[model samples]
Target chain A: MGIKRDISHTVWSVRGNAVMDVVTRSLEPLIAALRAAGYTVVGPTVKDRAIRLTEISSAAELPDGTGDVQEPGNYRLTERDDGMVFGYAASPDSAKRFTQPPRQTLIRSRGQVIEEVEPEAPRIALLGLRACDLAAIAVQDRVFLGGRHPDPAYRRRREALFLIAVNCAVPGGTCFCVSMGTGPKATAGFDLALTELAAPHRFLIETGSERGARIVAAIPHQAATGDDVAAADEVSRTAAGRMGRTVDTEGVQEWLPAAHDHPRWDDVASRCLACTNCTMACPTCFCSTVEDVTDLSGDVAERSERWDSCFTLDFSEVGGSPVRGSQRGRYRQWLTHKFATWYDQFGTSGCVGCGRCITWCPTGIDVTEELSAIRYGTEGPSCIR
Target chain B: MDARQTGRRPRLAVWKFASCDGCQLTLLDCEDELLSIAAEMEIAYFLEASSAPGPGPYDLSLVEGSITTPEDAERIRHVRRVSRRLVTIGACATAGGIQALRDFADVREFTSVVYARPEYIATLERSTPISANVPVDFELRGCPIDKRQLLEVITAFLADRRPVVPGHSVCVECKARGNVCVLVAHGTPCLGPVTQAGCGALCPAYNRGCYGCFGPAETTNSGALNAKLRALGMSDPDLVRVYRTFNATEEPFRRASEEAEGDA
Candidate 1:
């Protein structure tokens, strides 16, 4: 949708939100402003032939004409004729990498002297978080911050974040944010949000927080008319219709717990490599295990926490042997936990429906297909629940 | 712990059997930490480093290479008797190495083809891991073995604790390091799904599929991975060949390769 209506009435207020518009070329100034605001600006960039989140100093680094073709167990960077800045659906790794790092040192010891390492949280402005990513971050916040003893490192990183979200104009082949009610549009959990319109090559910006308002006031922008907002709405509306995959989340949060013996577990277990790809790629999978490492000399030692997956045999280790020893048990644990038990633990489903697990799986095992296999006796041809 | 607290360093001995001495060189490659490791333990009998031989009854023995000869088969039992704790290093010692390919074929046929005098050569029909001949405390899984993991195993044994070697797949390390899935993204037939994490997901980081140098992970569905590999244009022969590499004799790899060969 293009801004086709009359724009002589410069600022037609839409639902009491101060909306503005800026051409694509002005994103450089926004990047400069974020850098000037004492935040390390991280965004999606073309790295290692994929859309990877990395530190960027200029808006020129954004994947301008590059989009990604993502399918189950496959991802490829492609050239888009539309030249959309945020054309890609999701990155390989999400903002979770920035907030909850893969590994963190908890304590250090030399002989009898012990030292607890303080968490370091540098201010970061994440520039291109999608709606599903924001949902994933919210899920993580509940896990790491809403608990009795909040994770200090995760809390510090959470507080230090300045999120800039973007509405998805195009959905990838494995995306199911529409089914999860988490995407196609940025609803909340962002300082600022943008809907990139292609024809005129401009951004329809919506302020979500006071910090966003402050940044908007600092940057040069024109008032967005009702037509511009409608076009932006249309972009998300079209995206909502074009989801490549969908999970039947109807009673999944309740049903999956009982689906423990649903024969689908064995079917999936047969295909599941137990390689921990799904858990690792999942944005909201917050399980971790601590390891104590010592140097060649017996004097120095350190305890560090690294991301662990239920797919690992040691993850469920209790006494001498693993509780979930079989791939069948591990697979069941991971799927059931993500879809069902996560609500019991955190009052929210762990999956945000970004489909990273599907795209990153080496065997192209689609979660939607597995769920459908459980719900219906077959991988559904037309199931969108 | 007793060795250090009692004012005496534990004796560390390095032994070789049938294959290349690359695993031993990994110890010397630790130029920065070699001196520090030497300080912690007495380098009692490392033939590669020092010609000066120390007597048996060592505290820890780092054994490399596979048991391929009659003498090697007998020597391992003696080594096991002498050493308090025996740790096998590299694929050769832990899984019979590349030489274990002979386990699938006739060793006499190989000997007759290679050796000028086949009668003079005394060999075992199957090149097997040290564990097949004698007990092993820990087995460090890698082609040549990672030096850091080697050190960890050494120190952990000395300090009376379990080593921190994980049984998880290489995908864990690959994801932790933020390396994109080469198998998924590029349709490469990777053994990373079955291979254990040790080399820090080195192959995938460089945009290449893992050849399973560290052997099959604790949990692996190689049948499923082989199915995917087949979908990615890998032939049955290709599957057979890929699984028969560094960790060829690992049970899962051996079985999968045999299955692929059957299919071929």
Candidate 2:
């Protein structure tokens, strides 16, 4: 597939104009150009104590020189010494909300008249997407777009997206993309990838797609040199080094099934509030339930689809009973599926190794820790290797 | 007969066992989907939806809940005999549900906690999966199975092809949604790493941790997650409590709980 090609060495650097600096300066021009080209620019901006992807008319609206410090049940913003743009990672709100909104009108029916809701094509220029976010998008592509019954709305929106991926200059406390092999650098799946060079006000721009090439050509920037490439490489390496967490996925698929009868589930389940923040914060979760609403007249109604969590009792309602009645059953179902059985179904590990679940969980239940307990018996130390 | 080609409705029956009856409700919760599903299949026996139950050699039997009683065990045998194809739905039927918590504790003690007359309660020592006693054609994952996937399974079963329910972790769903890394963002405990991929990664999206409503994935390294939990400050008792949740009687969770209990 054209989607999976490696663009690791496709480095096209612009001299004197570091990618981040140029991105900051050219925000207005980029937005203007995209708008003129029939694209709506949406990127991360400070909102409700977190950086969220919202409509941006210019670069000034972006979160500049601000990064978030994340810990269990804690998230705070700190000012950066350097006035750098696109310095932070993904926000609490995932790009999935744009592609697969929390709630969507599927269809409307009135008496014998029936009409299907057609989603208007949205040409989106998503700015400052992290490599993990890009990997997440790829995962979603396999889910909604690659399935037998492709989600028309998701497919249309995805096809119209203009992605601007950025290599992480500074990793957050919870980031573990290095272990997941999803981030620190924008390896692929972007129209354009930007690497921020420190000293100079220039950017190292590399085009991953033809669309990226055109965008780079239109933007005002100088050609990048070997030094610029080295600077970008250093920035990526630093980001990778800063990751506070790691999960060894080596033979992970084989490991989970073998540990099926292991004794670690109970320990974790005890503290799990079953609030399901992890799934909500995850970048690749796509499970949802449909709802129908009718007016007082009871003649007109609309069917809507909304995001749902597996932690809830209603998520697995079958006959009149819940399959997983106890919190333990629910937790077991989730863990086993993520590590072991997913390979049987998707032919790929379901996890992209984003640490959203670890950070957002109210109880600080680390999946990596739980796996270690199961792999290395209870009497031993925490880390297996 | 080709149900799709000949327009002949496939006979469908819904069954239940020892559970909270939440999983079965997923079918009813599929309100709009249910109407369409009904149009495609003949509701041979669904006591929950209709009081008028029909006797049948059902083409497909969707069994929910779990067998926690001797009678239930015997009844499942009859159900398996009558149904051409039997699919276990929900965590209870596929993997003993919350009621299976009794498996660890004394049933008499449990009866004393809730019921006034311990003698009136007729229950088994442990709640077991349907597969333990009868052959199951398919086992849909989830505390309550994902309704969209549930519908897909039914559609595929009718179509006579393997259903495409991905057996990955909740983490996969989380990533696909582009959700911020919760573990990284909050350092909160979560089951997304080892949890199955269903419910569309809802808990994490809602700013909460995964509780593992879906059962174990194709392969799970729960031990690794347990070590992570300990490093995060979870006690052995805490670990035991975590495993003794819904589907606690399931082999993987059961073993994990026992280990935690042993340490405790």
Candidate 3:
């Protein structure tokens, strides 16, 4: 199922099929319809003082009336006066954590006989996904599925996914989805896209697929007028305009490759804690290592795939030496890979501008500011020296 | 066949000097992998887990703790001679552990502080890492080395290859877990950016700053971080205390602490 563009409430599929816009008073029926379709409804919920994307059974499970105040390394939940459903921006974790768990068992063996495990990808209806994350999922799809030997597990999970994209009503302090040209609006890669129009307390729904259309038709809904759809479009556009940061992606393709010798890298390394926090918080950064495990008896053994980061010296360990031995080298490697070399390999920029890397960086080391420093030769702070 | 019904298995031994025995406990914590490793190798000697001590000239030696006494200093040399590959495990064996904080103070004062008869308590003034006394082939870092990493080192020994261990900063792990930066957001003093990656950025996951249990990253930029900390309202004493924790004796942290003290 896919979503196509139209300022009007008409949504289209890949085959040029269109579905009319429908108005729903509350998000309660949508949740019920998704669950009734044998889908595990997963969305954002306030838990442990953070908006966590988890299994939600009803609208009450979502962070209703709650909004997030997010900045570089800061987040606080505030009560919204509007009581909007999609009040907050994206969480620290996108949809990647579930798709790629920190640890995943690959092979279970007894003695030398390796056994194949059963693949069970449940029907997961991902709700409240932002446009940047949609772009991230597309990138992950390319990395995990477009390869010669597709990760069978990731593929299984992808094939069973039912995407429900949400138009971001409010942009976070660190959001740069507008600069990335990825978000504020759910343009594509969704079976259904929603826009919350407050005050009237109604939702403008666009069914992007036949399944989405059927589901929308089943739920109690009224035909949306042109004004309602236009208001929905305005919400996403305003969110884009509200973004505080931007990455000059156009010049990064050229400047980053030539930036290997830039003194700015040394400057960044000085401030950089070399903590792997940025990569872990990133939605598209997919590096991993394998671990072997055996029971106490030594009879049963298993090899598990664990998430890894480039910050580790061993990530580049060879001949008892790490190629990127210095923080400068490592930081340069990471930023270059994300902005420059990724295009050389993937034909697209690696970062989605989700701003998780910025918000979660412990040091508040803004990637946008760092990239600008390297790009424009205005290395902001030489505080270390 | 040793124990696994295969060809001659590799010999493994465990040794301790001056430590909390935490790293030794980590080796035992490899409950699942321990049996598998035992099958592939001969558990020649591990005094904590087994009393059946094996002779030297062993294939792999996993040494824990630091050299505190003259006997420990001398005994490690013998261990180095017997073992083909000696891998130091944890902060004690790699960076002199928390006990190395005493290296900055008078050893006699410490002895007097603990012992009733000061003459009876014997220890070297400086509690040094295994590598300081003898050449170590590898160092598996951590207060207690990560069990999976320890397993990987052992497996690497058997396989005749270098273990894939990242010496990158703990920031990498924190990012990988998608946690918010405590330093930037809450102004929590974090050593993650300069500390070597291990323990999966655990402290930040629970909303606390890293204690640098894995030691400093390769060529740590504590200078920049110190400047940042000053901006965060961290007093000079707090900065000094930050650096003088578990792995205080490590070069980068030691240098940073000294600089902070100087500033104070």
Complex DockQ per candidate: 0.83, 0.06, 0.37
Q: lDDT by residue for model 2 over B56-93, one digit each (tens)?
A: 88889999988988999999999999998899998889
Instruction: Give the poorly placed runs of model 3, Cα more than 4 Å off.
Output: A1-17, A99-120, A145-153, A249-252, A255-261, A288-306, A316-326, A374-385, B1-12, B28-60, B82-85, B154-165, B175-181, B184-186
lDDT of 3: 0.81
lDDT of 2 by residue, A123-158 (tens): 888888888888888777777766478777887777
Q: How does chain A of candidate 3 score by TM-score against the true chain A?
A: 0.92
Clashes per model (N, Cα, C within 3 A): 2, 166, 34
User: Candidate 3's residue-wise lDDT over A72-167, tens digit each?
Assistant: 666677898787988888787688876777767888998889898765578899998988888888888777866577787987777577778888
Clashing pairs in 1: A247-A385, A248-A385
- Tens-digit lDDT track for model 1 on A1-120? 112322111122333654544323368878888888888999999988899889999988999999889898899989998979999888887987887899999999999999989988
Candidate 2 stretches with Cα past 4 Å from truth are: A1-29, A46-61, A68-83, A89-126, A129-385, B1-7
The candidate scoring highest on lDDT is 1
Worst 10 residues of 2 chain B by lDDT: B178-187
**Candidate 2 chain A: worst-modelled 10 consecutive residues by lDDT:** A1-10
**What local lDDT does model 3 show for residue A228?**
91
DockQ of 3: 0.37
lDDT of 1 at A193: 84
Tens digits of lDDT, candidate 1, B174-203 = 999999888887777799999999999998
Interface RMSD of each: 1.0, 10.8, 4.1
